[model samples]
Target: MRSLPLTPSRPVTAASDGRPALPPQHLADLDLGQRQTLLAGLGQPAYRAKQISTHYFGRLTRDPQAMTDLPAAVRAGVAERLLPTLLTPVREDACDSGATRKALWRLHDGALVESVLMGYPDRVTVCVSSQAGCGMACPFCATGQAGLTRNLSTAEIIDQVVHLAGVAAAGGVTGSPPRLSHVVFMGMGEPLANYGRVIAAVRRLCAPPPEGLGLSQRHVTVSTVGLVPAMRRLAGEDLSVTLALSLHAPDDDLRDELVPVNQRWKVAEVLDAAWEYADRTGRRVSIEYAMIRDVNDQPWRADLLGRLLAGRMAHVNLIPLNPTPGSRWDASPKPIEREFVRRLRTAGVAVTVRDTRGREIDGACGQLVAAETAS
Candidate 1:
């Protein structure tokens, strides 16, 4: 196993053209126009772009041999240039009777990232990473501890969804629908930090087939650790994806410690941006709070959180903290969690505890990658 630098040696910057250089350009990385132009340069007609897109986005198969409609002579070269392998699976773990599975992947540069596919009775959702590790530095998060590696390219992010979608379609997940219908950017990194690529990936995910994946935009969710500017920018993108604000703490003092980004954006500013997103998109913002044992689960804090979100276009998702290895943090006790929920409900805030999945398998975002790299 190759080890990756947990923290970037230098400050991370987006490529001048907003694409990462390490992973070779992929068809998913390009828009339809660029795809057409590339094929033209290869002496293939422009329509080959759409033909290839149908195989990838519509059929969810990237094997050149499976694209039988294309001329055999051109298949391998086209696949090499446009659908270069990006995520090589390192390890996969499953729990909840195989309904929830997590996969660790190695990028071209040896940086490790993870994505999770969860199957429910009615729908399937895949949580994907936007960056290899995270820069947020949230004390209780495994990914945050790993620190920033680099932003995943647009295709790197999208491929996770496409791959997982194929798994779901093939009935890899037990007792769940055979199709993937939802996506969440709540995996290994602070999604908004890798702003451009994440947004581009969302666009590709939602665009109709032959151009992109054709998933409904409303079914996708993008999470942020309160990057105020990026949150606000996402609102104007004409997208309606759910905005999940990982507001682990309601008060500034605790939040500054729990979510280090709070020190820069502050709780008030972050909530304001979330509200702005809700207003513009007409989609209720999801306020995500991790219930840590005696950390941010007190009744007072719940009430405070309720006060902030009450009567607003928001819903609180209380996540039971999935303690990382050697981390002091632990999930709030059931009684404490119940009390917290009661307070929020009393304050007229709609709230639900997120179903804890894949816990036995180090299901938290960065744990599997961390373990793989360590081994």
Candidate 2:
């Protein structure tokens, strides 16, 4: 087995990628005990940790003014130290009668990333980025094409969830539940590439009140472009969050181009790790395949995919390729897409075409950020 690379638990003062390091530590970066320790060092009572946590996590407000429970003298200090602004909303575009919203955020260092909020009658879901940009180099993906800036700190990742959750609770998503219930790490980066921070963020997001936003672990979905080592490690962590494998193509030959990581870990190896994850967690794996026109959407590939997943605890999420600007890729036609679904079903593999939400507003993963950067 290839040894996994070490990922830092806290942001460094500088990044090797020529991008600035992540912002200072935020409350979401620390566990309950760490929070207490931090407050004690600042000459504040340890119990103040819980009080501030209640205001931030439970109330979902980062404004020190909104945290009236804290003494005025301490509020400013605590807020400046632990609640420094991390994400500045640069732009937000809404569609689907306001059921779908995509937000472009400028990080403290001016590196931009995006998150999306989508609401249905039953639930509200937020898709968040794990990195400012992506290193995967999946030719058709906007973020991948732009390349990596830096890994987001654990707090940076969690802040996206908390902020969007607050928006949902305020009825920002039309005709839907007024609370955010689901989270997907599918916005800009290859999540597992920033393994340590992503795992920390997940734990913080799912922990109960005063510690986290109190979300169910099962409601969180983390997508990867087949980071085999990270997938195996995640299974051992005992987390039950859904694991989504971005297996854009069923065959290694085509996948090598669509998802360059395939060159390192072949299709069979990646799927084996995914199956192991499913077996250990008892959570069905999600196979994410992007249907690119005249690319990997051939009928034979669909049959091959079905054969590979037959009888496995997996579901195929067929994504119609959302074309990035100046990209040669395009979504498969309706007939081609329907036939792909049919083949998977005929082979007894569960499949569904992903809803193309926010298509008009540059909805696919990094589209919004890409446009912002270009401008």
CA lDDT of every candidate: 0.89, 0.89
lDDT of 2 by residue, 1-375 (tens): 011232222223456886676588899999989999999999999999999998889989978777887789898898788898888777777888889988788777778889999999999999999998999999999899999998999998999988888889898889999988999999889899999999999999999999998899999999999989999999999899999999999888899988999999999999999999999999999999999999988999999999999999999999988898788899999999999999999999999999888888888878877786777
lDDT of 1: 0.89
What is the per-residue lDDT of model 1 for residues 128-178, given as tens digits with 9 covering 90 to 100?
A: 999989999998998899899889999999999999999888888899999
Reference-based TM-score, model 1: 0.94
Question: Which pairs clash in the backbone of model 1?
Answer: none
Give all TM-scores, in the order shown.
0.94, 0.94
Alpha-carbon deviation at 87 in model 2, angstroms: 0.6
State candidate 2's TM-score.
0.94
Query: For every candidate structure, what is the RMSD over all alpha carbons to the true structure, in angstroms?
Result: 4.7, 6.5
